[model samples]
Target: MVAASAATCLVVTFVILTWALKDVPWRQIADGSLKPIVVLENANGTPLVRQGPYQGPYISYEQFPDTLINAVLSIEDRRFMDHIGVDPQGIVRALFRNIQAGSVVQGGSTITQQLIKLQYLDSDRTLKRKIQELVIAFWLEGKLGKEEILTRYLNSAYLGAGATGMSAAARIYFDKDVEDLNLPETALLAGLLRAPSQWNPIVNREGARQRTEVVLDAMVDNGKITHLQAGAAKSAFAKVNPTRPTPRSGSWFADWVAPQASEVSGSSPGSTTVRTTLVPRLQEIAEKTIADTLEKSGEAASVSQAALVAMTPEGAVVAMVGGRDYKASQFNRAVTAMRQPGSTFKLFVFYAALKAGLTLSDRVLDAPLDIKGWSPENSGGRYRGWVTLAEAFARSLNAASVALAQEVGLDNVIAAARELGIDAELTNTPSLALGTSEVNLLDLTAAYASVRLGKAPVEPWGIIDFKAADQPEAFRVGQQSPQPVDLSPYQSDLVDLLRLVVEKRTGRGADPGVFAAGKTGTSQNNRDAWFIGFTEPLVVGVWVGNDDDTPMKGVTGGAIPARIWRDFMRQALRNPGPDTMSDDSIAGKDNSPRSCNVSACSRAYRSFRPSDCTYQPYSGERRICER
Candidate 1:
């Protein structure tokens, strides 16, 4: 009677297996077809960035270390090579354990059953699904060799750190290739298959080490390694420290390039290369500068945040620090933080004067007076009685700047800013010249770049080229040309005026020991401090402030912001070398103006005085003028 009952059970099992195997596509178990991951490469061809839910390249069994294979087999299914597909002993043991715990505490699936579930079955814990998994595992083993099945499983497992496969996991954890992994590293990786995130070293180092010990013990019990060998491997793994992946620099720049990536690569994925205008060296310098400055002086000054954006005159973004630390905050202050620009807006005010038939020689009153009941005063409440617009700009006199803005319509000043590529909304108020309106660092820096570019329109961009897997060549982007403008002469003169600010004026702290020029800005109550400067090769904007809009402790633009700007530029120019000048004053530089011959300067002055010194665009030369 017992034999007859067993025969009846075997018949039922055979019928269930036959029914489950009928619909399965058994050929795919041997033929590998998996999508590869997308890679974001820098200009240097280094694969430094990637986003996932993405798959990495398939690693074949031949490339895997024997220790890794043995570790997985010993922990996952000790009888894998001996059994047909399902290990009956493991199932009975799991059932006994679950019964003792009064819950399902262990998975009894063998490696083949696990592969079948991973490839073809849903994760439903039902008798019917288990039957299907068992049957499909049998058919999969028949079609694919043991090595091929292991390869597919390893290639498809989802590891942490945005990696999808063993090869990528190896690279992410140890920065090593799969073939270079030592026995301990291989064992650690093998142990993570059960629960990737829970056993991640960065998240739970102790848990991962404990899991590795379990795998090492299993390997020893299975005779894959001796007890002594297991102990030695565990000791080696414990002594080694893994390097965690650092947050990428220029994260804001990367965010800007994300959308453009799809546009260039079309719809393809896997191993994409994006060549951006970012100079990694410059990016590192910019990030370190902001971090060091804030670390050194932020707490005492009541400041807690800062940002920087650096670009070329042609509008290629070389370096950008969105904030003090990108991991803590991702909002790009350089492109999105719209705080009041303060005296930095004086750059646009003076540029408006130049555009509206006013020369640097023209005079503006620095003495305070009420303008429609809105009185403006210089920073220190002391002012030079009457000064050249050039001197007024260099000193950043609030009253003089406002008076000049009144002389030229507020609309004209806004127009001048727009022409220079500033797109932020400007308020049409008397205090607009004092930069009561808020603007982002990116636009302001680009506007300054426009001044240095001398009629070349600014269209700042981050990408230079892009390529995806299966593509023949990189798709070109970020190619820029000088846009035509009628302000060449005025632009040259403006450059000289800005030179004075860095040479011997309020912006003196921004001097980079080179022929650099820029402007300083300090908002009300010292809430914001900014310095936007340009050398021949780079235009950099720095802003230091509190994120909560609280006031700082006298942190003017010329103080911390200028020092950061100076430090960054000194490092940037130290290699390519700066165009050193003979004297500290702009008047003694080789490119100092000889005379002003522009009609506006001549008409504004009654007689030619050397004190009427201003840059004149004459015969394609910028000369200091006595008009």
Candidate 2:
């Protein structure tokens, strides 16, 4: 009977062991691979820096310096390799110490055991937890060899303040690399494993040193270092310097870069360095020019807030500005502010006319006109009786424009604006011709740039890539592929007319000691004045207005704001060669000017146009002007 019972009991024990090992899956746990994050760098490859809560870049054991591994080995477990998975003598000693102390003061766990606890087990602090740890630790040892287990443990272990692993420990504690770590630095990292927050060298310097000394004592106890060596290391560690916070830079560059970051990160427009299309040097010149212009014009307080953005002819923003004082107001008026565009809005109306097949020479009566119930008057409040389509548009006659808007479809005008990326809900009414619909400055700038790029619209983006520091090698997924670049369905002639909008009509406001293109905008009652311009290499937008929207006497978009933009562009383009004023030969159809006759027209149109009988432009507009 005793022999049968013993045989049955042995079989049951073997079955139980198989069941426990079944769920552990030892083969797959060895390779703890992860990818590295990709951070955006500037043209010179300097990381586009941002300061915030630490976002850890996971690092691997291979990248870790030998000094770090040695320090940890020396301090925590010199016998790490010699032990199978646990240290029996240490556990027995801990139990005896706990009994003598009359409490569970210390529960001895090898580094390998602790790694199993941190990575895969629980921290219940009960007898059950101890047993659970034993099972997982046994499995870890069975699956990952001792070296693999140690490496993963060192790499994934949590340090402090959202940072994980030894790589972060190196950067956080010493602000240095693991390879560069000296003996003292190694000691510091090793001490942090016990309690990262408590032994943080930055917050508690003296305590950190003392705790590190305790690690040195452990090294002595383990015979990894002699007593004299421990004493000398402890003495030398006191001389290491503590980490300090990064410093702050003032104005200009901050004003330019911070807005880009705010737009990309979706954070409040405070100090940040977001990756922008703007070149750093180009942005500097733009700001310097604005400051000098303000100083020269003696309007620093008068025009306290201004914004600018430069873009490639292909529509990539190169340099950007939120305001003259980024520290004061974080509002990104360049990209965010919406106000009446005045004449800048006229390009859409003219384009709408062209799409309707209205030629530049087509005659349109510019007489005082009332639309439905609204009478649209010219800028100086006069009628331009009958003028050629070219003369009416070139001179910016309001009556003629409103008349033309009625000829072409209002929906087409809205569609044109939307084609250039303006999505604001514009009422398809006759008033749309009067520039009544408010639009965002950035959207308008981008729309105008569409005319320059001669391609499809593109949404503005600040960052190319964002990766946390120390992100693992395997985690680098980099930029997404098949970038959404659409450039079809847009008529090329539309961009050509847009270039002309800046050249003949808006040149006074857009010229910056170079051949550039842009438009000037003024809201009703002069509440807001805006100048949006671009050189071949730079796109500049400036807004001048009171925060209260109060009318400034005679603050037209062409005067002070234009002066600011011109000054800024002049400085911004000093290095880049002059913009080539290549004509985008308008195709599809010459629908520029509706019919207009200058015979006996009102003083407004007649004064803006010469008393001529016949005139013609490349876009096939007929007008009467002196040679």
TM-scores for all candidates: the values are 0.71, 0.60
Q: In model 1, where is the ten-residue run with the lowest total lDDT?
A: 579-588
Residue ranges of candidate 1 with Cα displaced over 4 Å: 1-38, 49-122, 127-156, 160-163, 177-188, 195-241, 248-256, 262-271, 275-280, 365-370, 478-487, 574-627
RMSD of 2: 16.1
Highest lDDT: give the candidate number.
1
Estimate, for each residue in 1-627, the C-alpha lDDT of model 2 and write its tens digit: 999999999998677666545554344344543322222334332333323333233444676666567767766666677777788876887799999999985556788888877765556676556655677776667677777777777766766644567655665555665567776677777888878888778888898899788777877776667789878888898788757323122233334444443322222111122233335555556667665665665353355556666655445455566666555666766766777777778778876676677777788888876666788777787776888776776667778888888777788888867766778778777777767788766677777766666554645443332222321111111112123334433344444444455566644756665566666777788877787766665555677776676776677777787877777776665555322112111110222222222222222232322112234545566644322
Q: How high a TM-score does candidate 1 get?
A: 0.71
Query: How many collisions per candidate?
Result: 7, 27
Query: For model 2, what is the error of residue 355's alpha carbon versus the real structure, in angstroms, after optimal superposition?
Result: 5.5
lDDT value, residue 432 of candidate 2: 77
Segments in model 2 whose C-alpha atoms lie over 4 Å from true places = 1-52, 76-78, 84-131, 165-190, 199-311, 315-344, 352-368, 377-401, 421-426, 433-443, 459-515, 522-531, 540-627
